[model samples]
Target: MALNSKDTAETLILLLNRSGQGDRAAFAALYQATSAKLFGLALRILHRRDLAEEAIQDVYVKIWHHAPSYRADKAAVMTWMTTITRNRCLDLLRSLPPEHGLNEEQSFDEWASDDLGPLEKATSNSEARALLQCMKQLAPLQRQAIALSYFQGMAHEQLARQLVQPIGTVKTWIRRGLQVLRSCMGAL
Candidate 1:
């Protein structure tokens, strides 16, 4: 890993550790460092500025409460934080009715995808390239589910509604899709 990224990662880990010990300043720093990325992820999944904003607020609350339980051995800091945000967004989506699907005025593809041919230069990172490769190999639904959840910070509820599929089905796609990605990447 590059020194800069490694430093950032280490810093995040330290912040998380301090937050777990009830250090408010460290938690504040953690929020400041990660909020923008988390907000963008929430925006992508929720597709509504208001809801995205609300979700981030709720996500931070959860993070504050759950920080003590975070185990770095289980997942990276970003992955853990993203999962919380995605789940909260999905919960919000589930409470809404089916007719509340994507608004025609808000073309998700227009803003959600910047189309740098997928902005997929793979970040000049080997892991990103490997992940992109594994992602492409997925079944369309599976791939979409993973991308929406991991890449776009989508929770399953909105993802199901967006894909026009049942919630259970969408969850299955994400679960199975993750298995494939893990297996494929493990080979690298």
Candidate 2:
């Protein structure tokens, strides 16, 4: 039950090394040390505890199965594990429908209910927040296009069809919308 502090660095390294070499006990220790934090991260993005927990379980399962594929020099164990968790979350998002799927425009407000507690505020950079605010300023159509393209896995043609617009119009809106968002975001 050691926290992942500097004091546990050596122990973590030992566990990672052993886990890489097929040691189940060391792998279990690694999961115990990091699952909570990883699940918290997933919950932040996915906004569902059950989904987050399932994602966390899937992530660790993959980690155990793929320990030997990890490269220590390429990333710290936590970073690698986080990447795995993020990919799993994205995959799950992709598999879902828009409301169920990754709709960037889907406000967290909809997900908030009496049962859900306040979301922990992530320490985002001021610049990033400003940029997000600027994106929020776009016309609803333009914003929808961008959100659909970036978050909903929709291609330009797909978005155009969905929006009942011409392909060129969708492309133009995305380009113009991005430029405006960038300039506005940068100024903030």
Point out where model 2 deviates above 4 Å. 1-10, 101-188
The residue ranges of model 1 lying beyond 4 angstroms of the native Cα positions read 1-4, 103-116, 121-126, 139-142, 145-180
For residue 26, model 1's alpha carbon misses the true position, in angstroms, by 1.0
Clashing pairs in 2: 97-101
Worst 10 residues of 1 by lDDT: 107-116
Model 1, span 1-188: residue lDDT tens: 23127677788888998999999999999998899788877876677799889999999999999999998788888878978988888787767786656576543442233232454552454566667777666676666566556544457887887778999999888788789878998998
Tell me the tens digit of each residue's lDDT in model 2 across 1-188. 33435556566677877887999999888877888778877875577788888888999888877777776677667667878898787677666666664344543332222221222234233443455567556666776677556433578988887778999999998899989977886665
Worst 10 residues of 2 by lDDT: 111-120
Taking all chains together, each candidate's TM-score versus the true structure is 0.70, 0.54
TM-score of 2: 0.54
lDDT of each: 0.75, 0.69
